[model samples]
Target: MMPRPLLLGFLAIVVLAVLWISNPAVAFAAGLVIALWQKQVDLPHISTVSRYALQGGIVLLGFGIQASQLWTLTTQFAWIVTLYIGVVIILGLLGARLLRMAATEGQLITGGTAICGGTAVVTLAPIIGAKPAQTGAVLGIIFLLNAFALLSFPTIGQALDLNQTQFGLWAALAIHDTASVVATAQIYGDEAA
Candidate 1:
């Protein structure tokens, strides 16, 4: 048998590879199961180091995203961005209520709009008293929507006759995470990248 660390390392790679397969965000929850089975992750006492890493990753991610480009958004597309944000806020609120979530859950969803994905959720957790489990659930839902958007949005942009710049703007403004927006923009064309 492989050494314990080697075996665990291999499993980690395989897990991440599976995650990259782009399945409708189901993989994330599935990953949680795998972690629990392997005893690799401890839900209680989730480390401060891990939390810091998450924050660091988001800040680093901003290096790739030029916030200034958001200004290039056309006057014509204002309504589109507004509608997208509105839908996210409304559905997120409704979903939280449907789940019998507290105010923190709603705050997490709102933070997702104002900032990058998991980063936003983590940051808002302390402020709103959101439990770690709820944060995980919200992150899972966002991951699902992001996966769906990444797979479908580019095609929709083409169907709508959006130029590279237009599509980039839409992706950046409409998508919940900077990573997803960047991925969508890059997939559409490097012109916007």
Candidate 2:
């Protein structure tokens, strides 16, 4: 017999697939809803499966990119990304000091906003001696802001009449996480990816 969570998850995917063409975010939102709904349904294995699936998807997404294109992006955006990292970090440090937040919490939040999102926060968490609760709070705030950006970025792109490169670069520069950047760029079209 199929496990309840897996079965429910499949059903949710099937249902969401119909709406995916209209909005990929709907599928993402649906899956999040499913995970929330499955709180008591052996999430350890389910989450493991989810993580592996995402890993495979990320690998596949990578295969679609060309080395030459990567070089072009590297040359084009390297300095820009570096500048943003420095500025964002410095600004975050100043804001943290101004707000009088706990140093560890502020550093985690800064790492998250300035680098590769949750990965940055998680990487710096142990180094900075942040508690799990602090990590979770930072993640919650970052992802919530990411969700808002994910929704609004397309409109902003259109309003700016941004070309693929411009939109992708903006998303890469402004978005907090890699996933949100990828998703936002994919929306702008394949070239943006």
Candidate 3:
């Protein structure tokens, strides 16, 4: 059974999240803070639940986007997306080699960087025979990066005087995770989101 204090702490976080927090990045940071405070509150299946929640949030965000707009944007920018992914992967691999990192770990990191962050890492982990420790490390790295992007992108976009379309495109291309990109865009405005 879960300890009473731990359970109360979790419940308080949930209540605060539901009642007050709206920003995804802030909510994530709050969770990180709570985890640090209660370092031993390990709940079984929490990872799986969090993963599904993230995926579901992304899906719900997609529903907000117009299908025609998505199709047009995808078709128009397909080449750019392909080229960016290729360059990032190649550069990541070379950087890993220069650092003399293991090939599998390097590939895992590159794949995560080039693709969808944790999702890419998790999907490739089993296929590439990555040890759990390696996967966890990569996920941690990606998660931190995503958090940074979420916090910084909007401020940078505004300081640079980027219009809604410009900021939206920049966020979509620059942020590693779809959810982060959307959240950053949302921070800018509804139009950007």
Candidate 4:
């Protein structure tokens, strides 16, 4: 039998390969399971690899978006987006204060919720002087929410009988990460994506 670390490393590679081709929610769930099962296993460079994979996915998805459609949507809904972000940030900060959370942690979570999830949190963390642990905690929270959204949004859209356009808009507005939004929309159809 292979040494335990080697076996775990091989399993990680296979799972990542599968994840690259599989549906986003399924891939996330599979990774979660593997992580739980091998909590002690340490894979070097996995974080860097995953970060690159996520960036690549985002870039590839960008290629699929029509600039005309994006411009139209942005022009039509810019005010709504601004208002939503403002309200969410205000409420998030208030709630964090009420809960007596750290200021940096609260801001990180609030930014993640009000903006682009992990991207927002990561971008703000350094500027806000967030410690590594605080940033990690906020990221973990955002990731969990993202996972939940990935699994539930498509189902909810189907149950509501949302059309491709409606479902796509809803997912874009409601989901945290771009990856999650695209994945959930893709579940509805290509047009939704």
TM-score result, candidate 2: 0.88
Candidate 1: count the clashes. Answer: 0
Which lDDT tens digits does candidate 1 get at residues 1-193?
Answer: 4467776686678667765864423444455566666674434554886567556755775576666654544465678767777777788788878888687867797778645776788778878888889889889977787777777888899999999887877777767786667666667876653
Q: Give lDDT: candidate 1, residue 165.
A: 81
TM-score of each: 0.56, 0.88, 0.84, 0.82
Tens-digit lDDT track of model 2 for 26-103:
656765776676555554486688678767867898899889988988998899999999999999999999999999
Candidate 2, superposed: residue stretches over 4 Å from native: 1-23, 36-38
- The parts of candidate 3 lying over 4 Å away from their true place are 1-21, 42-44
Pairs that collide, model 1: none
lDDT of 4 by residue, 20-114 (tens): 77677777777787778778776689899889998998899889889998898789778977988899899999999999998999999999988
Off by over 4 Å in 4: 1-21, 40-42
Task: State the local distance difference test value for candidate 2.
Answer: 0.83
Best by TM-score: 2
Residue 92 miss distance in model 3 (angstroms):
1.3
Residue 113 displacement in candidate 1 (angstroms): 3.1
Instruction: Pick the winner on lDDT between candidates 1 and 3.
Output: 3
What is the C-alpha local distance difference test score of candidate 1?
Answer: 0.71
Clashes of 2: 0
